[model samples]
Target: MIYLDNNATTRIDDAVLDAMLPFLKEEYGNASSLQHKLGRTAHQAIEKSRSSIANYFGASSKEIYFTSGATESINMVLRGIFERYQSIGKHIITTKSEHKAVLTTLEILTKKGAEITYLPLDNQGNINLSDLENSIRPETILVCLMQANNETGVIHPLAKIAEIISSKDVLLFSDTTQAIGKYAFDYAKSGIDICCFSAHKLHGPKGIGGLYIKRKTRPIQIEPLITGGKQENSLRGGTYNTPSIVGMGKAFELISLKYQEQTAELRNYFENRILQEIEDTAVHASHADRLCNTTNILFKHVKSAELMPKLINIAVSSGSACVSGDRDPSHVLTAMGIAAEDALCSLRFSLSKFITKEELDVAIEDIKSAVQKIRKDSPIWQLYKSGVL
Candidate 1:
């Protein structure tokens, strides 16, 4: 299959897999059991991986903490912060288009008295800085936002946002899950207090990710979500998934801006072809700065549910893979002022560095054919063609 859903997850890189093989086999020692030579070797490997990941983000090794994935990292950050600092303030600010991990966690926090302010997005899928500035109350403890959107690939201006909240006591937290490998991000310069991302999105092994908690003069503190062991500076517990951690480190080390640019070029070619060859099609968030590898297209009058099944050889998504099973329209699209019906007609195609121009061409032709066939049978398309309601 022609996979265009890299934002959901990427195929593991051969190098990353090779790096992980030793750990999965003979090097199977618990990182925390430091009394034995095997355990010491495992611990050293984990630390080395941590250092590599930290260096990629311009952060200190001490600031990085491993977790199962971005979802778990997000839960640990949101819930841990609320539990520890609810007495200082219970209010948190985030965008309405955040991944379900953040939204659903915030939902539970609400029951425990956390106040959430969901910032609105404009037609271009961007938040007004003024709206963010005005929403910060004295009780607001954190400003939670994602660096780049998973569905539309719309990017939030982190440096500007950091400047806005810099003077305020409120901490800035970002979900950098979709941004890390595809985009250039400097954790040290961004002034964000915390951020999270998963390795699977970057051609690394699944089930491994990291969270960065900034070390400031007056450091931020949060309760541990997983408690029991001394792992991760007591911030997280459990034996490390050594193979996955090593693979994630290799993945981070292998990130190349040149490759990302090439992928972006391919993505643009795909988008341009879809818009030019297919009538009544539009690209979502076209007005905003987006990740280089993503494009969400609106197949006007054609439902994605219908179009998707026809393009069986291509792997694309209507929205975030985490919520693909839900019957509702994409929350990200709807929040950007897209009508529910129009939102349902959109599809997200995210490219990986591994995809070639030849493959993209084939996928594009298949998409064009499938969309045309689906529209031929669509009553909505017929009404539009006749200029009738």
Candidate 2:
């Protein structure tokens, strides 16, 4: 199958697999056990991986905390800060376009008496900087936003938002799951207090991800999410997955070396081809800056749920992978003022390092043919033909 669903997950890179093979086989000692030679080998590998990941974000290795994936990282940061700072103030701010990881977590926190203000998104799925500024109050202690939207691919005004939140008592947090490998990030330069990312999104194993908690940003005290083992500086607890961690580092190294640039070119080619060939199609977040590898499209008369299955060779989605199961229209689209009908018809296409120009052309052809067939059978097409919907 042609995989245009990189945002959902990516195939593990061969280099990453090669890096992981030893730990998964011959070097199977627990990283936490330091008494034996095998254990020491595992322990050293974990530290090197940690250091590599930390270096990518310009952070110290000690500040990097690993978790099962981006979802856990999100929960850990929100809970860790909330549990410690709820007494100082009970307010949090976030955008309506965040992935379910942040959106759902915030919902749970809201039920526990935390006041939440969901920042509004513009027509292009970008948070309104003015609306964000107006939403902050004395009670607000944290502001959470995603760097690039999982559905629309709109890159948020993180630096501008950081400017607003930085001067306030609030701490700025960004869910960078879709951004980390797609773009460059420097925790020290972005004014971001906390950022979360997943290795699977970067062609690594699915079980590893990390959170970057900036040093010296003390708006909220952080407590452990899991107690025992003292892993991840006591923020997360468990025996470390040495092989996956090593694989993640290799994936990052690959991205830094070459795939990132090539992927950007492929994405651009795909977007250009789509616009040039498809009629009555609109790209979501067109007015906003976006990650180079993602594109969200709305076919005028077809539903993604109905369209995706028709194009079995090309993988895509209606929204974020975490909430794709829901029948409800995407909250991100709704927040951006898109009509429910249009939102339901939307599809997210994320290209990858593995996708070539030729592959994208083939995928686009498959998408176009599928959309044409679906539209021919759609009632909306009949209404539009009669000049009505």
Candidate 3:
């Protein structure tokens, strides 16, 4: 299938897999067991991987903490911080368009007596900086915003946001899962206090990801979410998944801007073709600065549920894969002022560095034809054409 669901997950790169093979078989040893040669080798590999990942984001190795994935990292950081600093301030701020990982975790925090302020988005899937600045109070201890949205790929001005909250006592945390490989971020220069990302989104194995807790002069403090063994400096406690960690390290090393630029060109061509060739089509967040490899489109009169099934050769999604099973329309789209009916008609097409121009061309034709077929059978289309609605 021509996969356009890279935002959900990407295929593991061949080199990353090769780097992981030895760790999976012969080099299998707990990273915490350092007395034996096998254990020492595993420990060294884990540290090397950690250093590589940390350097990519302009951070030190000591600042990086590995977790199962972004979801786990999100829960760890959010809950840890809430529990540790609740006495100082129990209030946090985040946007309405965050992934279910953040939203659901925050929901649990609310029951624990933590107050949450959800910032609203405009029609173009952007938050007003003024609203964000005005919302921060002395009681607010943290601001959780994502660098890039998973559905529409709309980018937030994170550096600007960081500057706004730099003087405040509150810390800035971002879910950088979607933006890590595709966009540029420097933990030191960006002024972000904490962030988390998954390796699967960057062509690495699925079970590995990391959290970056900046080591400042005062240092950010948080309690451990898991406590049994001291694996990640007592911040995260568990036996390391050595193979996946190695693969993630290799994935970080392989990230190239050249490949990302090529993918962006292909994505732009796909969106331009779809909008030019299809009737009554609109691109979500087209006016906003968004990730180069993503385009969320709304095919008026054609429901995505019906349209997606018709294009069996293409792998796209109605919204975030985490909540794709839910029957409700996309929360991201609806929060941006799109009606639920229109949200249901929207589809997100995310490309990866591996996708070629030839594949994108084929997918675009298939999408156009499928949309036409769906619209032809749609009663809404007929009514609009006949001016009867």
Against the true structure, whose lDDT is highest? 1
Residue pair clashes in candidate 3:
none
Ranking by lDDT: 1, 3, 2
Off by over 4 Å in 2: 217-220
lDDT string for model 1 (1-389, tens) is: 99999999999999999999999899999988899988888899999999999999898899999999999999999998898887889999998899999999999999989999999999989999999999999989999999999999999999999999998888999999999878777779988999998999999999999899999898888899889888888999888999999999999999999998998899899999989999988999998999999999999988889888988899999999999988899999999999999999999999999999999999989988888888788787899899995
Candidate 2: tens digits of C-alpha lDDT, residues 41-91: 999998888888888888888778778888888898898888888777889
TM-score on alpha carbons, each prediction: 0.99, 0.96, 0.98
Query: Which ranges of candidate 3 are over 4 A from the true structure?
Result: none
38 in model 3: Cα distance from truth in Å?
Answer: 0.4
Q: For every model in order, what is the number of clashing pairs?
A: 0, 0, 0
The CA lDDT of each predicted structure is: 0.92, 0.84, 0.91
User: Which residue ranges in model 1 land beyond 4 Å of their true spot?
Assistant: none
